[model samples]
Target chain A: MGDNLISVNNVSVNFDYQENFISKKQKIHAVNNINIKIKKGSFFGLVGESGSGKTTLGRAILGANKISSGNVIFHDDERDYELTNMNKQDLKEYRKKAQLIFQDPYAALSPRMTVRDIIAEPLEVMKITNSRQETDERVRDIAAKCRLNIEHLRRFPHAFSGGQRQRISIARALVSNPKFIVADESVAALDVSIQADILNLLKQLQTELNLTYLFISHDLSVVAHVCDVVAVMYLGHIVEMGPSRELFKNPKHSYTKALLSSIPSIDPEKRSEAIELKGEIPSALNPPPGCVFRTRCPNPGVDCKGGEITMGLTEVEPGHWVDQCCVL
Target chain B: MSHLLEVKNLDVKFDTDEGRITAVENISLTVDQGEVLGIVGESGSGKSVTAKSIMKLNPGNTSYNEDAEIILDNENVLQFTSKQDLKKIRGGKVSMIFQEPMASFAPAIKIGAQMVEQLLIHKNINKDEAKSISINMLKRVGIADAEKRFNQYAFELSGGMRQRAMIAMALSTMPKLLLADEPTTALDVTIQAQVINLIKDIIKEYQMGVIFITHDLGVIAQVADHVAVMYLGSVVEKGPVNEILKNPKHPYTKGLLQALPDINNLDAPLSPIPGNIPSPLDRPTGCVFRTRCPHHNPEGKDGKIEMKLIEVESGHWVDQCGIQCGQNG
Candidate 1:
């Protein structure tokens, strides 16, 4: 196996937003110059708030979102595939190697389809198995791994609860034997106990299948528990990136620190004097120059307002990277 | 000796197409002026139902038991039949901030106009006075461009701004009680923090009794002075926030605390409560939580154990689930 499963180098994805014929066209910088390398079988987390572009970045790596600049490289045992420059057939082949688990289980699955049909659909579309018997076998295998029994395969999506429905969603994603998966807030909709159950299931599957995950979520606590490497994104830019333990222990960027402090704790003493960022996150359409977080940064220097920091990361510690402007 | 709000044996049932279903059962809690009582629970726990019952905001299909009482400032809210009395309770004496700000707001009306209309109806104030008061409230909630926002519709504001505006409108009435039902659950973490801080400051400034309802225990620790942990429409555990968090007596409470992925201790495997919460129709006989409770004693006390709250400590109360009652009290 290669050292890195996926290498995203200086990739940026921007969307053209034009409300109507009367309105002026504007560029929404969804993923701007992000650089990340996911080691084989590592759980890499993309953490951010709403409008932080974490999901956009995840979709870009999954070859779903159109990239505006740079490239994405997917490394396998045989060869490396340039995801950004794939033809139709190559793209279809790449789709089988990678998959996405949606956030809302209720909306992801079709009500008309039984659990077996939902799981088998992925294999059928991906052309993984030949006949109905083979498809059924693959469906049952993945469902059992996801903790869904053979009896559950006959029932429609409405018959299952939120957590069970999510298990069905996961089984569908894994049925194609994907090497990598992008779980986009997969457990965000479930209750706490169910959320934990799903998280544990994900971890167990990862080890069993030797899977690499790009776990995108707004919750830092959940990310802390599961992810081996973490990247903190804000307003289309990655503010901090490093090993989860190191980054959580010693966060360098101001935005990273503020985001960490925002996680509410069960102990009242822990939340006291937390770095309460001023104002809401700025829109990606017209983010503040220099540092995007300058508007809400707790301590912005005089140069921060107008002076744009060089658009790249500086390794502050052994394996930690922070935006240069935020290091000050 | 009178409390700001006291809910005595609040039993709520809804007449559905099938039959009458118990939505909330024998739930009781009190909130004094300048105090915050947090109601923590997952879905089907009926925390929101308990909160809505205070303002009697549930749908027409709902029916309260004869012994159920919702007393607000010594007035029985259940018996309030007159429109004026109902008006006096809603927005006059009690205000509610919902999880979704857009749902509470009138989409067609200007933000300022709705605030002014509520003030005009409840406060016997002039239009000019109401407008100024509404603008002041908008400014107090830290919404920039207060005048511009006042003219804009609900769709114009961002999620955070909409929540702040809702909070401003809810507090502008200067009510004695505030029922915040998952007010920050929809917002992002940073926005959630800002809204939480705003609520804390508003509580101190206005001294409004707040009933904060959410599934997150972390939020409960931040905003609640006292907390009630609910499970399947019953308060499983009730105590001071510190005691409940640090040393929970109920198995459900302990399970909930352990289920949350502790940021400090990342290595410990998450122990989710064993199984899915039982469907309401198939509610467990003895204790509602017994189906999934790790400490479930299969042999119940004669196949019937009436749910009762046992005073375990000076202030703390836990449900008399035979397993925990004797050991705790």
Candidate 2:
């Protein structure tokens, strides 16, 4: 009853750009030494800017990206599989347990395929269920769970709006009855009104299925509404990890505070000056040494320059962990 | 004094394959010389179309009804049919910034070149003067290393930088009016805020009439002096920002304001408007929002939708037949 669904222990993914026969390679640390724990039935959020390597961390957990080092273990009620060292057969089985819900619903989905086929593709490819009737029933069940109209199952992706298409994407991801799902910017593309509808649906599905989610998005407000716990990433390193409310209320990192301040207030008279970041997000290929955020940090000190950026989740308060300033 | 820009009883139609579709209808608003006017609506609400119409930027198939009158600086821009007049209106006086920065900027051309070109086109400035003006504009938008970045192409810069570059280019001409259409929707929240503040600053510095078009209520609340809440291409509610935000009159506007996630109040769930934006083909006969209006009757008597825009309070307007608004108020 007190088991963890997924455990990412200091996992890092590095993409090596090697040239000709000389083997002069450059390593781009996309996800650098990230440690996160997803509870059996919890919505965990991973938030950062575009080049923060949040998406890479999600992919590392999902086994889409090659884990350069460290352990990523998936512990179910039944058994625990070491994700980093899984063989072909074991990895294939693990694929069924952990599925990905892509961000761009339009691009992720095939225009040629009907909604039914899109949903049924997973079941058929995985051989989870035999026969067309079985596939049809399974597709319908998941589609209904995702609040998709069964009548529209036969329609093409073009016929549906952005929100409806996202629902279809969700249905396809959950058709195989996966225990864990990574929804990367799932509602970012949708309109504000539609974003709420999708968020409601996701919450409902999480409770109904008792599913674990690794919701990745740059939208802090949306993350606040749904996620139980959140990890703030900056240039491949997670600077802060804590409960959503705690993080929102008292952000430890300077970047997190700046990000929080940037959110526009709905009240007309209550407008505050947004904390403006000076320089753009540095390139991942040629990342700055020492603290990855030192370039953009408003309160950067001498320690931020030479000190190596590491993810040490120090207990800021009860159940709240934040990476402290190592230089001091 | 009269407003800088005045749009009254505006109705724009496009001849599509289906039929003549009314994109915008009965939108009446004004923007003072130094005031920022926000026109907000969801997709298919004709927010962008309305802004484009001010510059006479509508497509060839667009059929502007006779009832509409778009007056810019006491001159009727709705009747601008010739290319020369439209050009003068577009870049010379009323400059625009589009949503997709990459799509708007040329892929091969340097950011500096494009800005200088835009400046030269409208102002007939010398090459050296244009270059200096472009660099200054870039600096104004908070672009670090403006001199260096001016040489870089659009793709070389990040999304936020590209948008800043776009704004710098648009403002370089020193246009009287800035028509920004969903300018910051594509950027991150942090970037969006930066752009919004930059726009606000520029609007104030230039004392220019700005019409900011967006789907976000929060943004409009922050930047706009007066906001016109649009639904199905018509101005449902038009008033001061405070009035619109604190006490929204229109059902569509109320839905939009409520839909925004209130960070201050965490207890209340985001109340997104139920049902999708109605298709242009299936637009209602009477009120455009009647089909999706939660308050209006779906199955009314006499096959006529009775819901019409009514001034509910001293400066607030709303639909007449609000079924679910009493509880909301």
Candidate 3:
């Protein structure tokens, strides 16, 4: 069927320190050798705790971060575009096909701008519309699709609640008719009830617009339900990758198991049995040499403690990959 | 047994530029020594306001109802109007850890200096003793290299470490009560678990009453002995944590439970409350949640049920409006 829309091949994003007199020459490898293919219309989830480089990877996919190495290929019906080496002209065309929905609704939308202007900024900036009338028409169409009342178009961001503000951001992201959407912790700031509403809206929009979502979040439960496939990141490395059901039902990596168990369950009794990871996430600047999770991994393999090992994925089962250092 | 802190008819209203907004309405809850009373609610549900009222921490333009009373150790806390008395009440007898640690700490001050200052306020200890105790408190909260960290500022520490330092400062006084207002909400899940576990252990060790305010039921189930589910200022339902999770009665509580994404049961559909939380200015007449209540009854006078929390089961409470109008068992 060959319907893979975006394939990330050995994508490594490194942030090099400025070589000033006082500064030492060091590099922060934000994303290290990541490879994953997002299907045409599937909800692909990239989940990890903070500082796990999940956000960096998501931004790398969007061409926001300067890639140190590797290439990202975007497949359309007509041609294959190398996202990493895209020229200005290509990037402009690529911008229409890919969009990003930010996490903080309060910070993302400008208080000075009206809801309509916020949604129309992308169209005007990208020169996707010929006239102001065309931009207004497209903004109104997307706002209605996002369930925003027509009267809300005139109001500023401060007048709307978190959920409504998020709806506005979603409408803004979708105004350009992007096929690939990267919603990076879009509902993390929302209340539980409101989070569900936003999530439902996202799902509905995905189907109606025929969109492929790269949902990045630290909350595993939310991703487990919303995504078809899940990739668990740990310190710039993907420790586990599999179908959502299979990953939750049978996690292969030690880090994945610890993460899965650490989620506070609604059932009060489940708290006691949680496998508590001993310490906080290690500094991303200097992660453990052999296994990135060795410092906090509940169960470490023989070579995991201090020895250097190749950071590679092993197909533990069909369509299920685990980090090579996993004790199993 | 006497409660460490008791809030009765606690109604808080803020006189804003637009209009007077009712923050908390006719609220009542008690926290016994060594007990954790969780107040769970969304942004505008007034859980933070209730927590703030305990320490008289609400800012200017805020007014407590005339009949409102908070009893601490058999003494009324509201009467302590003088700075002399409020100074002792603020951190000496009751300490609070906030959601954002960086905001609470003075950027100019060192972590050790802040903790030692708090310790000195509550206890008549020498500077050296206070510093040692501050270091010990930092160590107790699981911060590595406590001695080094003690000299550092809030900005120097990582998020989890900063939160730990905040907890260290809060506990340095050995206060009779602790008010943790969404202390772990901003942290990652793993760090959140660690903090929750730390709180659980400290709760056992200190036996001091704690008022844990958060919006997540999952966190409440972990750290709380009893939970009060607030909907737009009023506690719609409350009870023992087990009873609240296993057999929630109020439609709002049920809706919240349904909204939670069950990691184990990922297949189940999420039924979030139908409508957005009504703005405080346009809040419903009597049960504030009636606008979004799935089991709303039109029979109540002007579509408002008498606001009352009734004990439907042992240690479990459901708002009278919910019970009377609820169509489901």
Candidate 4:
């Protein structure tokens, strides 16, 4: 944990939703009891389908989402802060150390604002720099690092293409010099060629800035290339966690195996294996007891549904952790 | 055997507020019965525009060139006159599925009612026959509990189920050709695999020609028999799926293939094409891809370079002059 920049300890986020007009409320477990440690300068990936709560967990780390229980601790050489109980002033200061890169470049940036203003906004709101000149200089520095031309900064976002706009978004995220950044599906909206461009830029920046990333995405192939360690989440619980290569090559959990098999191979000769999961993701409001994934698991036994089974991490290999119950 | 659909020298332009912008240019491809032709391109590359041109589904501002010809079953669809003539060919002979399954359906209507309505309009059948056909089509597309799913609205179904319903509706008419525009793009990977398999199985069973448009090369590799790689409204490379994927001739095609992160080779570094795609309004002269093409040389002895499509092998074509220009002094 010494090298871990951010450590999440048993975090869970629950939301209350009205069942009907009848005054009945139900709890939606968006992010169940989870623990993850993002190492310094490492690209950690959190992957799942639409309702898997990856986004919520990412937001919780940034102090944007409410944490119903558990703690999220941010460690740095200068200072350490527990985000779950931070006051408003401390949270504001914590914001300068953490930021988010949004998913849709089209909707994320303001159409009327120029690229320079968009990037400078974080510095201005955070009061990191005093004078406008200081903010302008910082913006230019980060903009060049992100490969945005100085002349293009004066132009509005509409003038830039999807890839260029994403670069601007990256510049905006980096303006405050954040240590931990959550890039939530940042390249999901871009084309494949452009997606590579953004992905390479992110990897380069991670090393250059000595930054840590909690990259949340649903695309497995993209995650396989950019991330060092990967965690697969289902509903809200992480069923498998290991190095990217090891997990992708030999997945221990059945859910991880199904996900790896679902990726359409580029080689036309190789057809996907017959391991398709049946039915859609279950509703988080009424998730199945015991194992959250047991309803869709190909092999299920009486023990799988005995009671509310909490998964204890079992070290399958060095630095690899999987749900203990997953092993038949 | 005659091709089910043939598009020759097609060019589409739109009268925009700024000026006339060409959406698609000189694109040509053919889809034989039971064959799937993939049109792969990035956004604004005019892949969807080309698909829409088959059914003339573009807006009123769209203008097609005089020489453009879309021959469907030996009849030129561009020459379609009267609403009835277009109607008979549009949804009856050729049906389309869009990227957003939820938006494609009406919120107020039930899934079964919508399918039945489409059937009644296309086929001169009674209400009872239409209902039965609707239920059967839903079940054929792998929608479990078709009877129950039929009564539910589009909102009630999940993303995967909605896409299945959309497919079932599109195939209910028994069309000769199917135009699928990113039908599985909105689905999760697991669901996308399921939908892709369903589409392939249906194409085999019905023997219907398909024009599958997507930006995902992996999906194209799994489904398309022939691949047409488009860039900035032009087909940069066209060949059989194996030839295009394995032995790509064009520089743009090579860049695109290399850009994708291969699952088998996770450690390989991705080489994205440098520079952004030139906007439609600011399209470069000569080759449309020369602005960002790795094999583009602006300092030619004569002047700017000129590119032409050259047949590299049987049923394979690439831009020849672009490569020569980059290498020549």
Candidate 5:
């Protein structure tokens, strides 16, 4: 794992919540003991349904969410820093190095701000550049790379379409010259045609800048297309993780298999098998004691519910890790 | 195979503070009994507006062209004047389910009460019969403990359950036409699959004509018999689902298909349509898709290109420019 840029070791994020004044407080295990390593310059996909802890994990890595346990290590050619225990100054530096692109382009950009100002915001906030001229140059360079017209920079965000606004957001994310980016549902809100455009732009930028991306989304096909490595999360645990091709072609976990089968096929003649998971996802507040997915697992047995199951990754194939309990 | 609904030369416009915006223009489609017409388009493509116009569900500021005809069972629905007459057509002849199920339900009211109220308005059934029918519909939609869930409010149920309740309520009246506007878009993948299967089964059992609108071509391919590809308030192509998916004729259709990341072919490069869709207020002159079309003649020097729908194959119609552009390529 020497080439790995970020390594998450047994990381967990817990949130305390109360129903009302009368009810006792409860700890919601948003992301339970998870471990994964993302290689440098690779597009790693984090996929799950809502409440699967994918977003929480992404936030945890970006230092937006407090990690209750374990560590997230960020490595580069210059230095290495543990994100979970970074000092104030180090955290600020990490902020410059790692950035985020939001989901809704309509809401992500400030309506009143011109496209130039929106893209230049990170530089101004972080004081990464010395003068306005430098910031303007950086913004223009990234905007051009993101395929935004130079003249459109003077107009407000409201004048742009969804895909253009997304490009503006991408330009903003890229202006900081970050080494890693967490694109949380970045293309989910755009039209399918526009989604492909943004995805192609991201891929192109990744190659040009040598950047790593944590692409988080609920859409499996989109992830299967762009990502080099794919990790499937259920509840708070990663049930399956492997190279994109191997994972989609030959999934080991039952949950992963079920999710793949659930996608409505584009081919009219090829109907997916009836492998629907029953019941809604269990609440994170008081998740089932044992395997979090046991309730919805189609092939669960007594061992699945006997005791609390900690995630243990077993490499079924080279570089493909699946939960041990799922295999056993 | 009789026609259940026919929308001819429909044009919908909204009077906003800025100006009048045309949402659906010169659009025509027909649905036969037990047939599913899948309308696929992006967010602002007017698919929802087309579905809503069948029942005149738009706000008071909406205006329709005088020649616009929405005939339901051979009766023009747009000409309905009396509130009672429109009500008879709305939930009686046609029913709709929206993307957000929670917004569709009355929050303060119990699910059972809301469903019962809809039944009472549409049918001449007694309270006991309505209650039984509501519970049975809930059970049919695969909700567990239908009685308990029926008594609960919309907030009490989960997302999937609420959507199921919405479908149950929509289908309870047994309308001749069902307009589902991205009903499963908000659902999880597995849950969406379940709901899609449920809708397919219900369509079969009731023999209801359904106009399913969604942004997902995959979902349309699975359930729709015929499909209409919309762009900038116009249907660029209309054909059988299999034909459209397997061999798309329109450049936009081909671009859309090529853009999709196929799970089976992970290494294939996606070819996205270049340039953003023009804002509705700034629609182009000739073909709406010509702005981003790969086949557009950059140096043709023609003043304006007139595009018309031409049948490329039996049961498959594509815009003239789309075919011309493809041939040039």
Candidate 6:
């Protein structure tokens, strides 16, 4: 991958328990060992249901989470840093190079701050600008790029609709001029018609800024439409990874098949035989032996009852990889 | 043919800090026995308000116009004046399931206790009979270990299991109609698919009418026999599901179809609607969708909002447009 921007190699994030009296000290494996590469300027997608650890992986790459092991390397030209071991000054520099856009526009923005202040907060906190005049000029330039009316900056987020508030969020994320950005479900709360408008805006901005995005969402349809490369996650693991078109057309894993079948089709006459997996998702605290999917796999047999899981990522075809544990 | 439920010129209004606002206007739809009617619209489309109207579950500020008569079978639900009469019609004649299962259920109360209470209040049933019937209903909905789960609280169940418990409680009384308001929007896609199938099977077995409201058109295609597309506060179009999906005549409906992510056509880009919905207070005159309609072009510098509803085709309709179709005659 000549244009690889983000290199995540065997990174794992675990949340520590602080309670004093629990007999079995517990640690939540929010994100297990994961390795992937995001090409420069590509709209890469990370998709999974809640509690699947997709969000944690995105945060770990951004240096937002405490990584327990492995390293996340951000490469642009020859300037690559080991994110897990960065010092205070180096971490500050890394933070300026990468930023996050939260899922909830309403809660992410401050109610008391004006739009202008909200966009300028990141610059002020990072101490990137020396004077107020310089800060205002930078905010105005990014606001125009995001298609926000400069006059709207005088108002608060409560005065805007869901779509408008999202625009302000985009301006905040882009004002830092970061090389890599993580947009976490930025348009999931907006209407369907508005969702398209926001998506178009993001695509246009990506080209203008020469930015790489890690778009995280559970809506596979949206992912299929927007992302260049897609990764599927289940219970803190990526079960399948491939180009968007390839995976949608010929999904190799049974879990992928079930997820694809779940998307509602607009054509009433077209109905796929949906795979109904009985029983709830097992707790991550105590995962099952062998493959995590073996409990729900319809093809589970005597071969699936052991404690050993097939390791390594096997390439089924060009640019497509499925975990070895998948029976295919 | 007699319809299972009918709303005649229904209008619902809410008094807010700004002013009195109309949420649903002149809406009329009929659900035949054993048929599924889908009300499709995004937020602020008043899909849920219309469903709530059938059960008279709107807020105190909501006032139904005098012409509004929710006819269940033949009796007007609004005419049920006394508490006893309203009670007989509410859970006995029709039952409703909501979007959030946790919010709908009492967290402190045991699942079995709540079901038994509903049965006792509606019908002249004893505790022993209600408990047995509740357990049987839970089993029918495919809940394993019904006896053990019956004693558990709503918080003990998972998202999918909680929804099943809600369905069991709602259907135990065997109402003639079921009103589901975005029932599967909160669940995961796979879990959502299972719930959709469960509702479809139950409707078939009982032969009861259903009013399914959701923003997802894909889910509607799988379950609905008839589909009604709603804009701001009114029904833009209603027809057979296949006809509307294949050949959408209304501009708003066309935008919805184009906005959807086509799982079959993975290569095509999604063309989302360009603008947000106008607030009800600032609604454009004539056609409600003209502000967002790409075909509506202002001829001069005036650039005023277009306000005319035009009938473009038989059994299909659209607002006045700047685009010339050559079939205006």
Best by lDDT: 5
- Candidate 6 has a TM-score of 0.94
Candidate 1 stretches with Cα past 4 Å from truth are: B301-303, B322-329
Q: Candidate 1 i-RMS (Å)?
A: 1.1
Q: How many backbone clashes are present in model 4?
A: 0
**lDDT, residue A232, model 6:** 90
Question: Which tens-of-lDDT digit does each residue in B133-235 have in candidate 1?
Answer: 9999999999999999999999999999999999999989899999999999999888888999999999999998999999988888888999999998888
> Candidate 3 — what's its lDDT?
0.89
Q: Per-residue lDDT for B122-196 in model 5, tens only?
A: 999999999999999999999999999989999999889999999999999999999999999999899999999
lDDT of 4 by residue, A1-328 (tens): 6899999999999999996789788899999889998898889999999999999999999989999999999998778899877898989989989999999999999998989899999999888999999999999999999999899999999988899999999999999999989999999999988999999999999889999999999999999999999999999999999999999988998888888888888998887674788888999999887788888887766788663566667889987888877865
Whichever of 2 and 4 has more TM-score, that candidate is 4
Clashing pairs in 6: B285-B307, B286-B307
Clashing pairs in 3: none
The residue ranges of model 3 lying beyond 4 angstroms of the native Cα positions read A18-21
lDDT of 1 at B308: 80
TM-score of chain B of each: 0.96, 0.92, 0.97, 0.96, 0.96, 0.91
Worst 10 residues of 6 chain B by lDDT: B320-329
Residue-by-residue lDDT tens digits, candidate 3, B1-329: 77888899999999998899988899999999999999898888999889888889999899998888999988788888999888888998899999998899999998888888878777988999999998899999999999999999999998888998899889988999999999999898878888998999998999999999998889998889999999889998989999998988788888888998989898898777888888787768877777787763775425556679999988888888887765453
List candidate 4 stretches off by more than 4 Å. A305-309, B296-308, B322-329
Each predicted complex: what DockQ? 0.78, 0.66, 0.77, 0.79, 0.78, 0.72
Q: TM-score of candidate 3 restricted to chain B?
A: 0.97
Please, what are the lDDT tens digits per residue for candidate 2 over residues B293-328?
Answer: 666354432226454556666756665544234234
Interface RMSD of each: 1.1, 1.5, 1.1, 0.9, 1.1, 1.3
**How many Å off is the CA of B275 in candidate 5?**
1.6
Over 4 Å off, model 2: A18-24, A305-311, A326-328, B296-308, B322-329
